[model samples]
Structure formats: C-alpha cells, structure tokens
Target: MTARPPSPRAVAGRILRHPENLTESEQFQLKNVPTHYPELDALIRHVRSFAAMLTGRQGERLPDWLAAVRQEDGPPGLHTLAAGIGRDRDAVIAGLTLPWNSGIVEGHINRLKMLKRQAFGRAGFALLRKRVLLAR
Candidate 1:
C-alpha cells in the first residue's frame, strides 16, 4: 500500500474549514498555519481583526481602522465595502464606535411620517405640526 501525503496548504485549509475532522494536536497546528504561509494567515487575520474592530464600540479607534480598510490589502470585498463606507466615512465611524445612536431621532421621524400619511390631504401642515408636538 502507498499513501500520498497531503500538502500543507490543503491540510491547513481542511483544518481551517473543518476543525472537527481532525484530532486535538491537528487542530492545534491549524492555529499555527501562519508559519507555513504568512500571507494567507495575514489575510485571515485582517478579516477577523476588521470584524472585531466593527463589533467594538470605541469611536476613537475608527480613524485607524478605516485607514486599514483603505489600505491595498486584505479581501477585495473589504475594499468595495470600504469604498461604500467612504461615501459616509464620518457617519460610518460614528456608527461603529459611538455608544449613542439616533434612535430618538428615528422615532420622531417615524412619528412625523405616520402623521403626514394620516393627514394626507385631510389636514394641513399646521395641523400636522401641532399633532407632532402634542403626540406622546
């Protein structure tokens, strides 16, 4: 019988994709795959790091993280998303990092919209404004 050994990248890929397929020691090696190919590992790290940054509520770190996104590296999807984010860079950063939100403002907006729809052609702007001011 003959057995052909698996390539490190393939082995690592399997370990990365399906850790449940390997033993404890093999899973441990998957964690260390960066040594085999730094670029692949780095790309993975960039993705995970970006995700971690987004999940955090630290607005102060937003500038640096956005710059990292703009950098010519990581996944192409990230670049596309970053470009979209760049359209409202300030707002995106605020959304990602700030602990506060515009829930109150949005609630008011929804109320105003509802009032407008309810009063469409029936009541005038003045009446709508009064209702907006008096509504709970």
Candidate 2:
C-alpha cells in the first residue's frame, strides 16, 4: 500500500520549525517535499531565508531578498508579501534591525481587550478600570 501523505498543517509546521528540532521522520518528510512539489522548494528556501534574516537582525539584506522574490517565479503569496514590505520598507527594516519593541505594551493592550470582552454588558467602566489596574 502507498504511504499516506503528510497533512498540510503538519508540513507547514515542519517547514516553520528549525531544522535541528525536527525528528527523523519529519526530516524524511521534509526531504521529500521538493520531489512532491517542486515549487514549494523555492517557497521553503525563501521562507527560511526570511526567517534567518528576522532572527539574525539582518535587515540590510531585505532589499536584495525582496528583489530576488520579485524576480523569481516564486509563489504568488511571496510576491504579495514583498509588495507589502516594500510599502513599509523603512519601518520593516527598523523593526527587524532594532532591539526596541512594543511587545509589553501590546501584551497589556491584548489583556485589556480580552478583559473587556469577558466583562461586556456585565460591568461598568469603574469596575473595568479597577480590574485593569489590579490585573496581574
């Protein structure tokens, strides 16, 4: 009997994970990806390169990478991503290269939003304010 193909979500998880973290079976499946879908090979390369640049703070390479993505017959989604990045090139580069981030502020905002949703129609602003201030 033919072996069952890996699920799309499983394949995507494997692709997104660091190569060193993959198990033997996962590595084998990843190795066969290019054979099953040649176009995905280019996508995988581009995605890994982008991930490397983001993690390594190599924002200087964004322009060249964008150009390569636009020039190659890569997946259409990558072309869209390239265009979006082009629109906010400076901000994107700064975010990628700089050490500063608004993660804390964003987390607080998310928590506040979730609290508000949970208390919707059940509490007044004063109670909500107290909850926000007292939240750990």
Candidate 3:
C-alpha cells in the first residue's frame, strides 16, 4: 500500500487498482508498459536503471534539496512521502533512501507470468479462468 495513514482495506484497493499510485521510488521502478514500447532499447535502459536504483545497486542518493520539496503534495516527489512519514527531512536527502512497491502487484505479475509460461500461449479463455480461480 501507499503507507499513508488511511485504512488498510482502502489502501489495498488503491494499490490493486492503480499500482501507479505509489511512492516516488516505486514510480521510478515501475514499468509503464503502455507508454514505453517498441523502442525496446530505451525501455530496457529505463527499466534497468530504475531496478538498479530500487535494488540499491546504483548508489545514487536522494538529494538534500528534496527536504524543501517534501512539504509539497502535488506528486510523490521525495519530499511528499518523507513529510507524510515525518522522516527527518535530511536523513533520506543524503543517504540513498531505498523505497519499494509493496510487492502485492509483483506477486500478481509473477503469478500471471507463471500462468503464461505454463499455458504456452495456447490456453482457452474458459480454461484460463478456471485455472486462475482454482489457483486462488
């Protein structure tokens, strides 16, 4: 979930409906499949860079300037969530703050991948539905 102070059920609904509604780091890591396409090279690079940062391999850190920005609420820029969590504005600014998507969507994606691989792109709709229902 977004980790804001709302109800867990509501947050879960939001998470499932729009994984895009995420923390700044989550947004960076998520693949906007609809917009990024055909240009596999650029898409791959963006995804890789995002993944590296999320996984803490890139070693880049959030900037101190973000402390001021966090007070604003337009987008989930570093400042937005930082302020939400009452974090020391400077703590994440200097250190590479590692944030992540909640893993709920990732689990669903993984399940879908498994289904696709097992079906080998030949499964009928009814079978797919049955498999998905039974799998649950």
Candidate 4:
C-alpha cells in the first residue's frame, strides 16, 4: 500500500517546531513538505528565522527581517504580519529584547476572567472574589 500523505496540521506543527526537537520520521516528513507545496519553503524559512530571533533575543535583526518579508513575493499573511509589527515596532522590539515578562500577571488575569465567566449569574461578587483569592 502507498503511504498516506501527512495532514496539514502535522505539516504546520513540524514547520513551527524546532529542528532539533523533530524525530527522524518527522524530519523526513518536514523535508518533503516543500516538494508538496512549493510556497511552503519560504514560509518554513521565515518561520524558523523568526523563531530563532525570538529565542536568541535578536531584536536588533527585526528591521532587516521585516524588510525582507515586505520585499518578498511570499504569502499575504507574512506581509500582514510585517505590517502589524511595523505599527508597533518599538513595543515589539522591547518585548523581544527585554528579559522581563508579564507572564505571571497575565496568567492571573486569565484565571480571574475564567472564574468570572464560569460564575456568571450563578454567583455574586463575594463568591467570585473568594474564588479568585482562594484559587491556587
């Protein structure tokens, strides 16, 4: 029997994943992605470089990367991403360069929102406040 082609989700996951983390079979699958979809080659390259920048805190390279993306005849999604970044260039650079993050505060805010949604019309402010404070 012929082997089935990989699903789009699988291909996307492989493209987004770090190269070192891929298994042998996954690596093989990823290598074949560009053969099936030629446009994906550029997407894969851009995604990998962007991931590297994020991990390496190479914010200084963003301008060049954005310029390349804007100049390329690649996917429209990429252009959109570049435009969005351009609109908030300073904040994006700060986020990529700075070591500090609001992860803990965001997590707490998310938890509070979830609790509020779950208790809507079922509980009052006192119960919601208690749930938020008592939550681990």
Candidate 5:
C-alpha cells in the first residue's frame, strides 16, 4: 500500500515558524501552499506592525497603516477596521503620540466590569453605578 502524502499544513506551518526543520521536498512544497495561510500570515504581519507602532510611539504612521489596511485584499473585517480607524483617526493618533495613556480609565472600566459581574442579578443599576463610582 502507498503512504498517504504529508498534509500541506505541516509543511507550511514548519516553513513559516521553523524553516530549518524542514527537508528539501517539504520546503519545496511550501511554494505550493502560500495561499493556504495567506490571510493568517497577513494578520500576523499587520498585528506586529500595529504593536510596533504603539510600542515605538510612532503615531505618524497611523495614516500609512490605515492606507495599507484599506488596500490589502484581506477579509472584510480589515475594511471595517480601516473605517473605524478613519472615524477615530484623531483620537487614535493622540493616544499613539501623547505620553498620556488611557490605562487608568481602562483599569477603572475593567474593575467596573468585574464588579458588575459579581453584583449581577443581586443588585439594581443604582447599586452597580454606586459601587463602580465608589470603589477604589
């Protein structure tokens, strides 16, 4: 009986994350499977770029990133993301460029969410709001 062929996924995944581990035939097979992970690959790259921008405080690159998102032949979600960025362009830019961070507000919001979950069904809106406002 003949051996079943190796899954393209194995070859492709290895080639991407650890090319040195693959044999010549497996490496050659990678050329055939680029389309299999195209969207995932693009997502990784775009996310890395976005993280770099925030970490580096390179707000000026927002426009270019938005442009790339709009132009990429990616999933529809990307276009929606581009539209969101466009709508809040100024605020996003400010968050990137300014030393000020929304971390404090976000922390408060997260605390409120946790408190709400803990108080859900046991309390009314008034109590929930009071807890959120009064909590340290």
Candidate 6:
C-alpha cells in the first residue's frame, strides 16, 4: 500500500500533540531557527560542526550557573563561575545561585510511561484517563 502524504497541519498537530518527543536541545534549535530551513536530516551534522568544544568538568557543566561559593565574611551575592575556571578571584563577590533543572519533567514522563505499561491492558481508556488525571 502507498503511504499517504501528511498535510502540514497534520504534521504540526502531531508535533503539538507529542511535543515531549523533542529534546530540550532540539526545542532550543527550533526557537531561533532561520526561515527557509534546510533538510532536517542535515541539521544535527551542521549544528555539531558549530558546537562549542567543552573540555573538563567546567566545560561539561556548560549550563550550570555556578562553580564555587565564598566565605560569609568574604563576599555577598552569586559566586564567580568562569573565575573558578581560571582560579581568578579579583572580582569575586557573593555565594548563592538559583536552582534549575529539566530532569524532574523527564522523570515524571518516565513515571507516566511506566504506570501506563504496568496497567497491562486491564484498565479501559476511561479508567486509565481517570488514573492519570486523578493521580497525586
């Protein structure tokens, strides 16, 4: 059988309905994407070529907001992260930072999938929907 061509609206709807299928990195790319986009298959390769060369722990923690803390009497606010990379403290000041993570969202999604699987086809659509909606 021949496959049907998906309408642009159908493609957009599928993407909207299953947005979680896209990773954080992929979502970021879509936000600033230039018009007249090239083939999707070549995007990863092209982007990888321009990707940052992160080295060591400091580089590994590219998105991490902080690298170190200061003494109570030593400073005031958020600590210097890039300074820790070079052991430079001339402009060092505070000792606090904000907490941020997408990990919890990923965890909840995994939990939902596990719950759906453990239902084992025993629960009807209504019951499954209720369980998902009413779960604490």
The lDDT of each candidate is: 0.68, 0.93, 0.47, 0.91, 0.76, 0.42
Least accurate 10 contiguous residues by lDDT in model 3 = 57-66
lDDT of 2 by residue, 64-126 (tens): 999989988978998999999999999999998999999999998999999999999999999
Global CA lDDT computed for model 4? 0.91
Query: Candidate 1 — which residues are off by over 4 angstroms?
Result: 1-51, 60-78
lDDT tens digits by residue: candidate 6, 1-136 = 9444445564344334334666665455443333324343233322232132221222333323232222212122223333363363222221112234467899989888877887876987887788788775
Clash tally for model 2: 0
TM of each candidate vs. truth: 0.44, 0.91, 0.29, 0.90, 0.58, 0.29
* The 10-residue segment with the lowest total lDDT in model 1: 11-20
Error of 3 at 92 (Å): 11
**Which candidate model has the greater TM-score, 1 or 6?**
1
For 16-88, candidate 4 gives per-residue lDDT tens digits of 9999999999999899878988888888989898999999999998998999888877878988999999999
Q: Flag the better candidate by TM-score, 4 or 5.
A: 4
**What tens-digit string does per-residue lDDT give for candidate 3 at 1-136?**
6433444464334334344456765444333322433243333333344444445633343332333344333233333444553465344323335444347988987997787679876888788788877886
Please say which candidate is ahead in TM-score: 1 or 4: 4
Kindly report which residue stretches of model 5 are placed more than 4 angstroms away from their true locations once superposed: 1-35, 112-136
**lDDT preference between candidates 5 and 6, better one:** 5
> Highest TM-score, which number?
2
> By lDDT, who's the top model here?
2
Cα TM-score of candidate 3: 0.29
> How far in Å is the alpha carbon of 94 misplaced in model 6?
24
Task: Please give the ranking of all candidate structures by lDDT, highest first, separated by commas.
Answer: 2, 4, 5, 1, 3, 6
lDDT per residue for candidate 1 within 1-136, as digits (tens), equals 8344457676647534544567776666656666655555646555555556666666566567668767746556767876887788788778877788889999989888998998999998789889988988
Name model 6 segments beyond 4 Å from true: 1-57, 60-100
